[model samples]
Target: MPADDGERGAAALAQMRAMTADICDVIPLTAEDDFRITTATMMIGNALLVDSRVTDLEYDRTPAHIARGGLDHFHVTLCIEGEMWFSSGRRDVMVRAGDICLLDMGPPNRTVLRGGGGRTHLRAIILQRAMLAPRLAHPDAATAILLPAQHPHARLLANHFAALMLPPAPEAGSAEVTIEAIADIAAAAAGGTADIAAGVERAERHLYLAVIKRRIADNLETDALTVDELCRHFQISRATLYRLFETDGGLAHYVREQRLNLAFRQLISPAARETRLIDMAVNMRFSSDSTFIRAFRRKFGLTPGELRELADRWLRETGAVPAIDTVLHQLARRRKS
Candidate 1:
């Protein structure tokens, strides 16, 4: 659900502008404006809090309340509780209560709202360049595209964002976290490269990527493992593959780290207490013990033998243990230990 007109909606839009370093507008279609465009213009700058913006503009010439402007950020508009028509370049679009529209700020665009003899509320989110640049290298390249509001995940995220925009801000720390997660979710949902997981909760964008990470972790033991192999198996583009791992660390970095974590767990576990380090390396697909030692040292500032010794000491210090404490834990447990 999107916003309904009231002080709450107005305040939320105001707060959004203050918190996010950009401006947002919440407009309600008025009957008097029907058959007459109130305003239409182009937008500029970085807007990411909602959807993509592009450098194009068009209208149906079907007189109505119109909104088009230049914004220094990404602009997202949801035609909640009304009927609306839009033209982006040559493409004409119709928006209903559940249909959300994305406008590129750097491009010229126009929108017309046809009211059903009732007030129509629309929510627009404008995000700054500083806010979106880190997540995407070329954000503008994705501008001027309208993500269908029918997408379940996109609707879920849009609804959540709308809810957040309708309320007063929470405590500062919580609000900050919520805002970042909202941006990440919006970006992921609108990216349109893959499907968002089923049963996704509010503000858990990172959790979706965790699935990809776990997949990589599970396959680390294969001697021929590489990002290309993982990407192929997952059917994701190189950029998406890299983006999924970016928050965890970097893809190559995480692969090496998980491999080392597995090795460390294997070295001290009772099931592998007598397994030769060289053999362990071979089984773990380390091409050479020296290479393994170098990576281990670089990661943990200690040699493999030293880490194993430390793990043994830790195990001895803590008498109780799981059946498969390290590498086995990964295979058997669905969640991180």
Candidate 2:
């Protein structure tokens, strides 16, 4: 049973934004604009089925929003009417009527929805990260990707989610089973095993590693971003943390590399020139400027000043375009290895 808000127009948009923010942080395009919106949501066990119809709008989860707290869930959206475009990191996908899309809420994502002279209607099933963790490997890889409704497993999951949103929804016990089934099907569609017991331990390990890396990236600017703090936050033993990053030259090395890379980006940015090197180092929790510079030079074969000079020369010669795709690809490869 979808619970609809009685408010109309702008008020309805405001209500929708508030309700959505409760589930996950989003900057709703309709929040400040005049838009006709009608929305409803129903909870089935740990899953939330959202039904929405609104004017042209977009929802953005910015880096700042992700720094605050990323959404710990995945959205399986089934387009009922109109179309929507979803973008995250290096992937961009558009889904139309009868199409299905998977969106990982943990990453910075943007969704542009258009009404096409009428309200754009959609049904989205939001699944908690824990629910899908056991069945899928590298679940984040499935994010911002489209699963055409025609695919066998995708069709199955889509039909199941649609059925769950219908009147006289499944009983509590049945809903649990249905939700598990949906996850299993989604896992198979995502190139994971359908059997939960098969490779589940490895899947869980991957999920934990992914979560830890995301947490570390989000808190890189804070002085509290240490291995010990991560252990406490994730309730894992120190040995486990070391084991997780052993292939990446240990946890400390990984964090240092990330911080250095962040600083390198900041150094190359024209707007960041006003930010002092020592201040940036302190913000990144580096003990001192000398230590930070040494680490940065060791990683990139050049000091921060040298890199910034090279960046400026390149920008002057060819404009300020960065090879973003190359960077993303390198990051993806690093994550995989």
Best by TM-score: 2
Candidate 1 Cα misplacement greater than 4 A, ranges: 1-70, 90-92, 133-138, 166-173, 189-337
C-alpha TM-score for every candidate: 0.37, 0.51
Error of 1 at 203 (Å): 5.5
Local accuracy of candidate 1 as per-residue lDDT tens digits, 1-337: 2322322344443443354332223233332222221112222223223222211122322112123332445655666666666654565567777765555444444566555665454556666656744444345554545557766444644544444443332111243454455455555544522232231243454433443454555577874457787666545568866776676588787777778878866765667778887887777777888888898777656677875665666678777443434524433353343
Could you tell me the lDDT of residue 154 within candidate 2?
54
Query: Mind giving the per-residue lDDT tens digits that candidate 2 earns over 1-337?
Result: 5556534565666677777673434444444555766668888888988888777778877777677774778888888888999998998899988788777888788888876776678888889988876567677787866778665445545555555665432111255656665565556556564465464444444444555665566677986667788877666789888887887788888788888878877877777867888898898788999998898877766677776676677678878644534434544575578
Candidate 1 overall lDDT versus native: 0.52
Instruction: Give each model's whole-structure lDDT.
Output: 0.52, 0.70
Q: Which candidate should be chosen as best, given lDDT against the real structure?
A: 2
How far residue 134's Cα lies from its native spot in candidate 1, in Å, is 4.7
Cα error of candidate 2 at position 54, Å? 1.6
